[model samples]
Target chain A: MVISRILQKTGFYFLIILVLLFTLFPFVQMLSTSLKHQYDWGNPSLIPQKLNWSSYSELLGFQKKEVKVPESIHRLLNNPKLSAEKRQKILDRFTSTSDVFPFINYFINTLLIAGTAAAISLLFAVFGAYSFSRVRYRGRSGIQRGVLLTYMFGGVLLMVPLYQISVQVGLANTSTGSILTLVVIYVVQTLPVSLYMLGNYFRSIPESLEEAAQIDGCSRFKTIFLIIVPLSLPMLVTVYIYAFMIAWNEYLFASVFLKNFNEFYTLPIGLKSLFVSKNAIWDRIMAASILTALPVVFVFMTFEKHLIGGLTEGGVKE
Target chain B: MVSHPGSLAQQEARFGWKTVAPSLLLIALLIVYPVAYNLYLSFFEVKLSGQNEFVGFNNYIDLLADRAFYDSLTVTVIYVVGSTLGTTLLGLGVASLMNHKFPLRGLVRGLVLLPYIAPLISEVFAWQFIFDPVNGIYNHMTVEVLGISDERVNLIGTPGNALLVVIIFDIWKNFPFAYLMILSRLQSINNDLYEAATLDGANRWQRFWNITLPELRFVVGAIVMLRFIWNINKFDEVFLLAPNVKTLPIYTYFTAFTGTIEQGLAAAIAVVQFLLLIGLIFLYIRRVLKW
Candidate 1:
C-alpha cells in the first residue's frame, strides 16, 4: 500500500508539472516575442539576444520624427532651452524605420476609462448590495432577476446602440464618455452577482450582532455604516478587483466605441494595431499585450482565494 | 417586525428606493432605452445614412425570405448545443479528476482558467496562428510526427468544418468556468455523506450517482442556462475565428456596417437576439430557482 501511494504521488506531481508548463509556455513566448524586432523570428534561445525597446519607444511616441516632443517630457529631461541638444541624441539612439504607435495616449485613455468605471461600479454595487442584504422590500427577488437579465445579452448585443449613442452625442472618441458608458453597463451587469455575494456574507454574520445594534437605538443606516461595512471589507475588495478586471480587459465595446481616433485608443485596441501588417509586429504586440495583462494577472494571483470564494458562494447550497 | 408606526415603514421604503435609485436609473437609461429603441427601429425600413420610412413588418418579412438568415439560425443552434455539451462534459470530467487529493492541485486548477482569462483579442490572434496552414503547430504535429501526411486541412476555411472548429475553440475557451462552478460544489460536498454511504455498503459509483448528482443539479442547471445565453449572443469568437459562417450577431453587424448600412434590418436582428436572451433568462430563473 505504501509503495502504491508513493507511485501515485509521483504520477500526480508529473501531471501537474506538465500542466503548468503548458500554461506558462505561451506567456513566455509572448514576452520573448514582444522584446524582439518586428521582423525578427527563428531565435533558438528562449531569451532575445538584443534588448529591443523600439516597440516601447514607438508606442510611447519616442521615435516620432514628424511630431515635436511634448513640453512635459522635454522639461523632465532637464533641457528647458528648447534646443535640439538632448532631443536629437535620444531620437538618434531610439528611432527606427517604423512609425511611432502613440502608446502613451493609449495607456492614459485606458486608465481613465477602466479606472472610472471600476470606481462607479464599486460604489453602486456596495450601496445596492447593502440594501438587498438588509432590507426586505416588495418584489426584491424579482428586481434581482431583472438586474441579471440586463447582463443576458452581455456586451456585444448592446454594441449597436452604444455605438449609435456615442456617435450621436459626440462621446464616441472621448475617454470620459466611453468610461461613463462602460460604467453604466458594468454596474448593471455586476450588481446582481455582487449583491448576491454581499447578501450571503451578510447572512453568515450572526443576526444577534445587528439586533444588538438595533437595541442600542442606532438607526438602520448607522447600523449598516458602523457594523456591516466594517465586517464586509474583504468581500468589498474582492468585488472591486473583479469589477476592475472585467472593465480593464473588456475589448468588444472599446473596439466599436473608440473608432479610428488612435489617439484615444485603449491597450486592447493598441495591442491589435500591433498586428496590422504582414511582416508581423511580434515584439510590439507582445509588449503591449503583456503590459495590458500584467496588472489584472497580478491582482488575480494575489487575491484568487477571495475571488473564488465570491464566485462559488451561490453554487454550493447548504 | 414592524416595531415602528406606519410612517417608519414608508420611510424605510423610501430609503430602499433611494439606495437603489442610482443603479435603477442607469439600468433604465442604458438598458431600457437601447432595447426599446432597437425594438422600435426593427419595424422600420431605415438605413444608417439617415434615410427611410416606417414600413411595418417589411423588415421582418424580408428576414423570413432571406436564405442566409435561415442558414445562420441553423448554424447558431448547432454551435450553441455543441459548445455547451462539450464544455459541460469536459468541465465535469476535469472537476471530478481534480476533486481527489493530488500534487500541485491548486496550480493545476488555476492554470486551466488561462483560456477564459486571457485577453480575447490577443487569444484569438494566437488561435489564428495556431491554425495557420503554413506555420500552425496543429498541422505540423499531425503531418510530421503522426505520419498522417493527409492533405493540409484548412479547418477554418472549409465550409462544413469551419463552424465545427470554431465551436470546439469556444468550448476550449469557456469550459474552465464550468469547472470552477462544479469544483466549488464538489468541495462543498460533506465527506460525512460519503462515510455514511460506505457504512451502508454503497460503492463509489452508487454514492456518486445518489448523493453527488442530486446535490449538483441546481448548479449544473445554472451553468447550462448561463453558458447557453452567452454562447448564443457570442459574436467575437465566431466573427474572428470563422468570419465566413455568419452567425446571427455577425449577420447583424455585417448588415449594418459591412453591407448597405441597413440599420433597420440590423436593429431587427438585434431585437430578436435581445428578446431571445430575455426569454432564456426567464427560463433560467424558472428552472434553477424552482429547486
Candidate 2:
C-alpha cells in the first residue's frame, strides 16, 4: 500500500509537470525567438545561442539614431513661433526611419480605441445595470431578456451587413469611424454581461441601505452614485476589464472595417499584416507578438481572480 | 397624496428609460439592424459598389449546391466535435488530477490559464512559427530528433494536415476554458459522497463513475455546448493560423470580401450558419443553462 501510494504521488506530479510544459512551451518559444538574431531563426536549441535586442529596439522604434539638424534648421526648431506644419515637418525629418517596425502608431491607436471604448461601455452599462436591478419599470424584464439574446448573437454573424452599412454610411476606412463603430459594437456586446453581473451584484446589496438613503432625502441618482457605486467598485472593475479585453483582442471586425486603414489597425490586425507581409521577418514578428500579448497577460495576472470570477459566475450560479 | 405617489412612479419609470436608452439605441443600431439587413441581403445580389438586385433564393440554392460549402461544413463539424470532445476529456482528466493534494497546485492552476488568456494573435503566431516547415521546432523534432520522417512536412501549408493542426491548436488554446469550468464545479462536490462510496468498498474508477461523472454532468454539458457554439463560429484562430483551413466563417469572409466578392452568397452562408447557431444556442440555453 505504501509503495503504491508513493507511485501514485510520483505519477501525479509527472502529469502536472507535463501539463505545465504543454501550456507554457509555446510562450517560452515566443520569448526565446523574440530574442534571437535573424540568422538564429531556424536554431533547434530552445535557448538562443546569443541574445539579441535588435528585434525589440527595431519594433519600439529605438534603433533609429536621431537625425542631426543643420545649424540653420536648428534655430527654427527652438522657435516656439514656428507654424504647426513647419514644426511637424522638422520633427518628421528628425524622426522618420523606414527600418522601424510600423507598429507604434497601431499600438497607440489600439490603446486609444480599446481604452475609450471600455470606459464608455462601462459608463453606459452602469446606468443600464442600475435601472434593470433597482428600478421597477414596465418592459424591464423584456428588455433584459432582449439584451441577453443579443449577447449570444455575437457580432461575427453581422460582419457582412455591418461592413456594407459602414460603407454606405461613409464610416469606412477612417480612424474615427472605426473607433466609433467599435465603441458601439463593444457597448452592445459587453452591456449584457455587464448588466447581468452588475445587476446581480447590486441585488446582493441590502435594499434597506438604499431606502435609508432615500429617507434621508437623497434623490434617486444621488442614492445610486453615493450608495451603490462605491459598494460595487469591484464589479465595475471586472466589467471594465472584460470589456477592455474584448475590444483589445477583437480581430474580425477590426480586420474587415480597418482593412484599408493601416493607421487605425489594432495589434491583432497589425500582427496579422506582419505575418502576410512580403519578406516576413520571424524575429521581429515574434517580438511584436510578445509585445502585443504582454499588456493583456499583465492585466490578466493582476486581475486574475476578478477575470475568472466574471467568467465563471454565470456558470457557477444555481 | 394619491397624485404625489403617481407622479413618483412616473418619474421612476422615466428615469429607467433614460438610463437604458443609450445602450438600447446602440444595440438596436449595431446588432438588430445588421441582423435584419443580413437577412435581407441573403435574398439579393450585392456588389462592392452598393448595388443590390433581388435574386430571391438563388444565393441559397447556389450555396447549397456549391462543393466548397459542403467541404467547409464537413470540416466545421469535424473540427467542432474533435475540439469539444478533446478539450472536455482532457479537461476532465486534468481536473481530476488537480483535485488531488499537491504542492504548488495554485500556481499550476493559474499558469495553465495562460494559453486561454494570452492574446490570440500572439499565441496563434507562436504556433505558426512552431509548425513552420523549414524553421519550426515541430519539423525539427519530427525529422531530426524523432526520425519519424526524413522530409519536413508543411503542417499549415497543406490542407488536410492544416485542418488537423487547426484542431490541435483549438484544443490547446481552449481546453483551459473547459478545465476552468470543470475544476470550479469539481471543488464544490461533497467529500462525504466520496467517503461513502469508499466505505462501500468501491474502487476509484467505480467511485468516479458513480460520484464524479454524475456530479459534473451539468457543467460538462454547459462547457461542451458553449464550446460548440464558439468553435463553430471561430474565425480568427483558423484564419490566422492557416487560412487554407476553410471553416464556415472564414469561407464566408473570403466569399464576401475576396475573390469574386459574392456578398449575396456570403450572406446566405452566414444566414444558414446563424440558423444553425440559433439551434445550438437554444439547446445551450434550455438544456445547459435551464433558463
**TM-score per candidate, chains pooled:** 0.83, 0.91
On DockQ, the candidate that comes out on top is 2
Candidate 2 structure quality by residue, lDDT tens digits, A222-269:
998999999999888888888788778888888887777776788999
DockQ of every candidate structure: 0.36, 0.59
lDDT of 1: 0.71
Candidate 2 chain A — worst ten consecutive residues by lDDT sum?
A: A309-318
- In candidate 2, stretches whose alpha carbon ends up further than 4 angstroms from where it belongs are A65-96, A315-318, B1-11, B280-291
lDDT of 2: 0.84
List model 1 lDDT by residue over B1-291, tens digit each. Answer: 456567766777677777777877777778777777677777887655545589898888898899988898888888888998888887787777789776567777777877666666656665655555764555776776686877556767885788887887887778778888999899899999999999999987999899999998877887887788878888777776677767788888888776577878888877777777677668767775674
Error of 2 at B209 (Å): 1.2
Q: Cα lDDT of all candidates, in order?
A: 0.71, 0.84
Report the TM-score of the second chain of model 2 against its true counterpart. 0.93
Scored by lDDT, the top model is 2
